[model samples]
Target: MWLYSEIRTLGDIPRHYSRITPAAPALIGADGPVSWSQLDIRSNQIANVVAAADVVPGARVALLGKNSTRYFEILFGVNKIGVALLPLNWRLALPELVAILQDASPDLFFADREYADVAEKAIASSGLRCRVIGYDSTRPGRSALDELMSAASSDDQVVDVNPWHTAILMYTSGTTGKPKGVQLSHQSYLYLRLCEHLEPSFSYTSEDVMLTVMPLFHAMGVGLSLQALYNGAAVAVYSMPDPGKLLALIQHDRPTLLPLIPTVIQMMLDHPDAATADLSSVRVVVYAGSPIGLSPLKRALQAMTCDFIQFYGATETCAGVTFLRPDQHRRGIKLESCGSPLPLVELKVADSDGNEVPDGQVGEFLLRSPSLTTGYHNQPDFTAHAFRDGWYHTGDAGYRDADGFFYIVDRVKDMIITGGENVYSTEVEQALQQISGVQLCAAIGLPDAKWGERVVAVVVPEPNAVLVAEQLIAQCRELIAGYKVPKEIVFVSSLPITASGKVMKSVLRDEIIAQTSR
Candidate 1:
């Protein structure tokens, strides 16, 4: 009974600084700032509620909410129990939410008031014996997290969870089939977050504020939020991606770190708010989740004086294993490299047979690190296939240069086969990004009666930007071989992306297939 090994979170309020500086304000909200001590008390109270819920060890608890105080409190509580925390994507459709709820089949579902209706319908349809709890719902049937916290004590409860045991279940953007739950362990997350905590040089400190518009369901959101909490930094969160409001928060809060998706950045640059926002206090602007378009990339560099750190990772990898440092993002290096493997992680390229491929050889990127996930939930076969040879096969085809820098060619599933020739979609997308009119693009394979599958370019042209299909094809023809050129181009307003900020190529492929069939 004495061997309680499961709980690994910083359960107790540690001995932190107090009088070193003035406690003017911390955790900013719409109303005002919440002090550090306040956050700690709420966290402690929530931890008690989680334990009082009778959530046994290894219970799966789904946190379905946006970025708010309640979400933060619930996460702390979940950590206390050492149970698997599944963060649901609020942006997804009701049906999609239901699918994940059913698939995870958690012991409890905690959602935000905004998603209460959807949660109820999804729960009823799936018959998920899940006890529903939310910030706003039935006073008794649906437990308000804050209320529960007030009724409980401020003591930390430890569970017998090993570091190797699964801690989080993050589902990837399921474009083709159902979403796959990636199981990250405490050991992996510890190494991942610990390695990313930046020891500040001069500017940023706990005094600085930050804003996070990125969805909390993804690994990026989790990493950023945890980093701030772990370091006792303050953050101003927004549930929606409103560029104007985000700018106001930036100017109002004088944030030090702003991590967001490229799409959101693009919106801000195009909006009227960009001209007046006082971003002088911003020190680091972290961007990832997808490829950055040249136009927005240039604007972002010009707009913010902060360093741009782009991370290449996924839900299964515990967020980051490779980092494209701000220095490596020069005009010459940006297009060619995704930088080298991080110091805390290991990376290698391997062939289909699991043998390590030679340097500079293009193959599946195999990653072995303490930060990589243990496996997929309830998917033994998928896990076995992915975690072979003591490494997680990233399913990405890329090569490492002589200097040990890694370059992602494209997803193996996204490789376009045209006339018996293989064309990496990233190569084509990179070329398309350089075109004068092309704003966003994705290269996917579409069914062709003559060639089985033809290279298809799905592009989002700039406003009033027009180009003949033939001219676009010629542009690709000049850069790549004739066979590699996109056989057709489909222009759309925007590209469909997953909640984690990854482009859903499966969705694009399906759209192209449907149109081709018609």
Candidate 2:
């Protein structure tokens, strides 16, 4: 745990590892294993490149890519010069990406080869004059990141980066239909690791290998990967989540730590190779991002025969608030609970009036932690609304039992978490309204076996207007990300409305479920 105590900032992680365990494997990807020394040297070169470009402290740099060695290098390099790294979600559509770029206004942009075209288009549309740096593949107008790093100095670049400075600027779907950038500081990550060190449950060892399949844009992917690297463990990075390739990687790399969602868990278990795949190397399987059904939890436990830990939190909290330890994951033993607050976390369930609720009563979850984000970038109004009286107001509804175990019942904000992605119903409903044929529409999440919840649009067609489900779905696809698109469209004559003329999504969701079951 010397490394945990020594690292004061995110930039120090690579520097400490380079000296203590230079020859140890830090990352394992398709390009092969990269040692701690190599990682440190490469990150230094990256820092020198950005510094030479005259980017100053508190400036923003962006990376639009998947999970790769380049992503980590960019993350550390950007942090080295006291600049924040804004990781863009690759799955977002062009307009969505354009809006984010315009809002953030990063000084430089790094794009993976696969997203070169879209990245260029977003910059042009946003009218930003930032330089486009390419990785993996190069375009005619862009400079390759590898070539720049190769020619830059390997000497560590020192900048006055404080623990309060923003390290990562992550965007989450907003209720107002625009994404809000969550500003996470160096302490947001380092303090979480320190808390883990103090408590010592589900700890990582130097010999462990982490299988990282989640997207780098997410808090879970970045948080877990940094955790492994901080402990001198190796991370096996996959480009994306593919059940077949994941099964093969488990056999080859024999990763000791695995983190995933319920959807991926079911996919891997249903794969043809899962029955014969060797998953013995996995010591602990951690799941979060969304609620997992009791049935699927039991099925996964029976199939993998490894320790399972479920933690609950969001991007705003740096993703580690409560944890269901492996020892507590048994039948009739708080399986439905998301477990207790972490060592450094303070949690309370509050009602709408901001009053604390009694035990076993559902209310909004409010938490205070060192890992909590300072605020949303450039959105002071939003920050003021969510953070009050030294506590971050989580719009999630949950309850704590007499034994201190917390159970999440629902999301008070009406945010639909499908396949680990947060999809705001209001955002989808706004898109639906753009279509002429949609007179009235409400988006709600329904329980699904594959995805934790499937987005469903219950719509009332315009009078005498001809509309088809397939056509509406196609139109909706152009307005939002594919993941936010509703999987099914139900045409109803009328939608139940409240006295205030607001669509009652709860009643609609219940009705849809009853109709579907029939």
Candidate 3:
């Protein structure tokens, strides 16, 4: 009922910026940047291209690409006209991608030229209208990204959609199974952004330069980019994630704020250049998407003198409904916890029968927030299951301490029930990451006959790293409960990880099943 319609689109940013700080750099593409007026003008051009294509308001337009400035422009354009933007996963196989496309049934599909072949096959298989454009479109029919800015209108406003109307329908990365489209309303989007806005540290002042390494499709990226631009913060976007390049960008831009995945942070800590990197200007480093192991968490602290705040949330809940501030993390409390609730969010831990658990008991995490997704697209039954009794069941099992700090045990679906005892995968994975030879590790519950499910760890060793399962088990036995340790360790060259850098344990479970069966 309030006026968050004010932050509804890219157009909102220009007027806000012009009034607050006109010359502030609003967007920094890999090539360079544009002022607030330029970003809005650029989005307007993309909107014209969308209009010329005969796309009607309320039409569904699909975008298949990585993190690019053009992609954000397209997002603004499509949403400005009250059309829903669907961004397909670039990593999905063509067959699976085709299935998703069939579901959305988009009016027009734009394939990033980098993924031209895959996108072509995906669109071709689907019976949807489509075209291919170079991410850096220079040729005719290529529909260069710049063309949208030049060939189209510089319109200021389009008909606004209802706050309850859908904007972007982002599908889950589907690490476990088929991706489901998460339906985010314009208001819910604003609510999530407002949670961050509530923070006393937030500012649109010209002094704040934001460095973003997360993908544009991610909830964190979408939330940060829009709100930051609206507030007039200059944002430098990395089209693709690279440990070295990200550090260099931070050094060059001297970003005042950075919200990123733990893996990116760990990589930055590991980079040799970080020792000499010009990070004197960093004030806050917001880390999330996945929990950090204790070792990497410690290293990340030592690597940067910036205040670190770790947030935990999901696409379903916009972003951080809970945050562990730097002060709490440094005070030797909530080390494995994701922190307490944000201003507008509510959290509860519930059991199998949908009963809320005691404060100290581990159970599924559930949420009821103004920012939670409206529902999964076209999946009423799934939505009913997800949004139960006004609470969105997180499918994650965690407990709250007497002081109300939350601790994540593991995903309820990922818990191993070996010998009738529940085991949290993160507990073992954390222990495994500490072993000298272990470079990377993932723990998953594999189907088993003796035990309903057994804990299995897939590990990638460091160069010249060597370790036997027995040695690792002996090490784990001393540190954690025996039931919590992996029953077997399978050495892998690498892990299947999502763009946000969380280890895809569900993928690992499949490998574990095939190997165990044989």
Candidate 4:
């Protein structure tokens, strides 16, 4: 058996797996299943081509594409030559893409055929000088990825890649301000895999098939895929998240593991075909990125006969710090808790003065782990503030129970202060979720004359469900204190969510402010 400690760099994964399980399926996509031997050889060919380009060691190579098999090939290839891979989020606007390109300043830019125009616009806008190649395009001046791979040698080259060498430059989701690049090293990802090995809930075998629906740009997507590969399990890539398509794939491919966000989970359960879908092959379903409501969770448990695992963390922590295990779900204990920290991770809830708080008291959550990123890419001052006192401040308000389980309340910045009372938006949102007609809701503070701020709830009702503001407020008051109930309610068709499936609370706040002013 191969141990986690023996793995040094990302390149070692394919090399080791191919030797032991060369004929086994490594990746399954729309095209078909690719064997481990093919994965190793193709990645080597891409690495040789990249090495022959004469780029300096540690150079940034940016990739703009949706989820696909070629993405993984480029990922390993970039790491094989000691260069950092920056997976650009194609969902961002052109200006956002340009800003990131300007900051990364990659030595080479690779884009999929569908995103070539956007890549050209971003490069032209940012004034970045780099060789642009299309992953599957054969345009006039653009070199096709297939041609490059075919021409390069398949033999692996010896490169000096250390554990501390930076492997990825992932950009944080810019909800408040401009996104900052986070520098993650090979050691960080290796440590994360080690942590996963310690937890029984995350156990994987070569026989397991993982269905991946999250975007490759997000940390969750990358971590899940890497975990599958690390364990020598086969992975199936779904380009995007669609409830109907996901169900169809599950029925056809019969993947044993499916990792998704809460939003997608709810959509899958609500799909009309979900009742009759043959999801018996699924053994474990993992969800993360945001808190899931109790109502939706219960419904999902009834619908799908699979163990549910919930993870909690940010991009800085490599997408997981704590996991609510399946055993806890089976026992129905601490349903609201995000659960205990991983084996090698330390968690603390600290006050604004950086002092530890008592259990059951909400405070800012801070974590220390080997899997954490070194710091933000370029902003030294921001990095200093974030990594104070040898802990990465998560900026999330949460508390620990007497049983040692952690519960996330809300973001520190998302707290609502109204009439000298403090209100956590997550708490209010949880209360609102209990209402029968409400499908989704976000709580925010709006400007008020009498009170310092008024709590406002933006809701998206369930289909064919009529909801009145007064009735919803009455229901919320029954569950929580009157002060915590929403003073005003606004109904919308849908909430603005990020590609990773997190609600954009700042955008909602701005829209509410504009509506009140009018």
Candidate 5:
């Protein structure tokens, strides 16, 4: 067993685990299991190579890859030299990647073999002059990660690392506009681990085997993997999320914990293999990234014999601010709540004037925690606006009940103004989700000459199910106010979602506008 007092920096993790449980499995991937001692030595070698590359301290090292064990090695290795690790979203298009790379301007670019083409395009588009290294590739001109590791020494070296120093430069999803790089300090992550250690329900043990399908580029994946490593737990990583493959991994690995998004869980349950899959090893299942419908939640609870935990937060909050635990997953008002704040987190719903709002009144969610990001990198204006009055304005609109449970309404920017009345998109979407045929739906505001903006809904129906616009509107009208009802209903085969499972409302809104213009 390891004490929280032993962990001070990212460099301390491998050293502590290597000393205490040298033979324990620290990482288990498709290749094989890597023991703590091996991970420690390999990471040390990578760190030495990175430091000897003539790269200055506090420089950015960008990684473009899917989930892999090498990704973790590079992550911790960069941490040892006090350099920030910027995990680029490989799902992004060449143009988007170019824009982000230009903004980040990392000193080094590391790409997985599969993403070499995209990385090259991004580097070319941005005109960045940096060393390009390929992981698990024999491509000429580009250095190989394995060769670098083999040639470097495994002996650990001391580097000046400060808690307040930036450790990660995580770019936002950019659903609203250009992606902003969020600067997270080493202290922020350390504080997060402390919070997890203090909370028994969220804590991990060395005996636990955690199955992580979430993209390592996202905050949820990074935080979960780090927590498992810090606690000496073994991590089973899947490069990508596939329902059949995930079920197979669960049955084969017999992992104790699984963290996933609702969309992935829904797909897994819908798969034919789920019925017979041996999921008995799973004791806890953590889900977040978006609001899940009641039907799916209920079905998941009935099918899987495990604790269901709903985490609510954005990248800026380092994954979770509030947790909806299994015991609170009842069929009543609690179903609508995202649960209470986590330990060391302070939350309140504030009105436009920045004063705390009364219970049940919708307002912007504000939070204060040691785990919050330091600021947005290179965007002082945005950082100033987001971090104000000693609180991080989450930009998510929600309300607190008398019982202290927080219920999210919608994103402040996503709220619709119809006939001078405010309509929360989430309210309409929740009502739409209750309808039997609605598989997925996104509510947005379309520009209107009269109402300024009108409510519009794009829905995806369940397989073999047919939906009518009038019937859906009528169903929503019965549950919500008339103005909140979507004026326009467009049925599609699918909705645009980010890699992390969040609906890309900005993309949908643009498509609707284009159609209207046509």
Candidate 6:
């Protein structure tokens, strides 16, 4: 009974849901399901707690915690008072955390007790005077969140807020340098739901229970969860990234919706219980974070027995600019395509001069969507360069087919130039994935004496599967061009993966370079 028209901002989502389905399960955390009414009251309690900490409108509050119902409560509660919530990636190092803390200069900080020591170190290192509240327990004298919320009133905090006000201060993955905070307004997150409602291209129903396993700090995890909530769907929050536990949850909860990265999907399939696990309850599997290879896609399609949707987007665009719908997943028909732009999403492939390139030509992806981020926080110069003429330069290299399907070649920086020929690392990785024993693979450009850059591949083999470097190369040759083939393949047990499920290619490249130099 929650109508999209009634909800103006992120705060209104819980309030609207509580009115119609007070007893409906809003969130299922480790502690169990929290009803819509309870979530609304808890969010009000959190808002009061945030206000009492002297945090006001336009200020920021940073949270360092894993996935939980409390995260949503804090997010909505902070939004209720017009304060943006910056959810820090708990996987970050102390100095990294300190850097973000110093950059944001938040009004207050919240951390789970698990990260107490690191949070204290970061606060001390950054010399931030902001008060710290622990989700589990604060410092000796100060009251923790539970104590404060228990004492605070559950009355709604009414603060007039602009829909354009920043609700999330999400930092980039920081592969290149310091992580830049991308400011996403309430409208940036909400508009996509409206688009979905109008189009229904991968619509969420009230009966759907979205099981989110990705880290809450990432865009995909929080974004998908909010999208589900906006549609009156229950969200099951699983904090850890354990594939075994994730599979067990699927069997037990029978969640209808799954938004998972391909890496996690691979791990789940490789798990011992995957064969026997009951995954029939799942109606849709949405894969994102990175491009999934054909091998894993086939395996998932066979195993899950449900519709598979692939989303392609970036932090700049809060929602997916393009989606490969279930019907488009047919074998040997545009399998590599990420599908056309979503409704209300205008997309084009542009050359370096910013002119739109003809279809079927590789170029940078330029997109403009209603849910697009306004800009990077405190980085006007960087923002000016990226967002130009009403289009966001995505730095992704790809081309659209004649039929309107989009194919992502590679990240512009990730493209390898070998012997004066362009080689897409994603293409090479995709080819390598076709090999029988290959489990996970990352292709990178390494410094070469002859070629400007040589293609080097780091591969992880399946368990108990035997593989040969020569044999894999021979197999890859059949799948792709000879020039695109990797010059060398290094076998490993696992590749470095980010918390968001992306392979840390820069880190992997550096490690490979260091090992080769030695």
Q: Pick the candidate with the highest TM-score.
A: 2
Which of the two, 3 or 5, has more lDDT? 5
Q: Candidate 3 regions off by >4 Å?
A: 1-5, 9-11, 18-20, 131-134, 137-145, 173-176, 200-206, 415-518
Candidate 2 structure quality by residue, lDDT tens digits, 1-518: 53556787888888888888999988888768888898888889888888888788898998998888778878888898899999999989888999899999998998999998989999999999988888872232145887898799999867879889999999988888978999999988888876777766757889999999899899998888888887888898876657988899889989999989878888999999999999999989989988888888898999988899899989997777798888888544899999998887899999987899999999999999888998998899899989987778999999999999999999898999999888999989998999998899999999987898999999999999898888888988998899999999999999999999988888999999999999
TM-score computed on alpha carbons, candidate 6: 0.80
Tens-digit lDDT track for model 6 on 1-518? 22547788899999998999999999987677889999999899999999998899999999988787788989999999899999998766565678789999998888888887778888999988988888752232244888898999999978888889999999863334445899999988878876666665566877899998777887888899998998889999877557788888998778999988766788789899899988999989988776566776887888878888888887778757788888777444677788887788999999998999999999999998999998888889888988988899888899998999999886765766554344667777877877888899999988764454788889999999998888888777765557677888999888899899999988998999999999
Per-candidate count of clashing residue pairs (backbone under 3 Å): 4, 0, 1, 0, 0, 0
Best by lDDT: 2
Tell me model 3's lDDT, rounded to 2 decimals: 0.72
Candidate 1 stretches with Cα past 4 Å from truth are 1-26, 136-143, 158-161, 173-176, 197-208, 330-336, 356-361, 415-518
lDDT of each: 0.69, 0.88, 0.72, 0.83, 0.81, 0.83
On a 0 to 100 scale, what is the lDDT of residue 20 in model 5? 93
Cα lDDT tens digits, model 4, 1-518, are 23565568888888888999999999888878879999999889888878877766789999998888888888898888898999998766676678789888998888999998988888999998877778752232245877888889999886879878778899863324356899988889888887877776777899999998788888889888888888888999868657888899999889998998776787777789888899999999988865676777777877888898888877788768798899888888888889899888999999998899999999999999989998888788889989989999888899999998999876775766554344668767877898898899998887664454689999999999999999999888765557678999999998889999988988888887887779
Q: Rate residue 221 of model 4 by lDDT.
A: 91
lDDT of 1 at 286: 78
- Structure candidate 1, residue pairs in collision: 5-160, 5-161, 6-160, 6-161
TM-score ranking of the models? 2, 4, 6, 5, 3, 1
Query: Relative to the unseen true structure, what is the C-alpha lDDT of residue 413 in candidate 1, on a scale of 0 to 100?
Result: 57
Which segments of model 5 are wrong by more than 4 Å?
1-4, 137-143, 174-176, 330-333, 415-518
The sequence of per-residue lDDT tens digits that candidate 3 reaches over residues 275-375 is: 88888788888877655677777777777777888777787876678888778766756777898887778888888888989999889998888888899
Candidate 3: lDDT of 396?
A: 83
Local lDDT at 22 for model 3? 57
lDDT-wise, the better of 1 and 4 is 4
Clashing pairs in 2: none
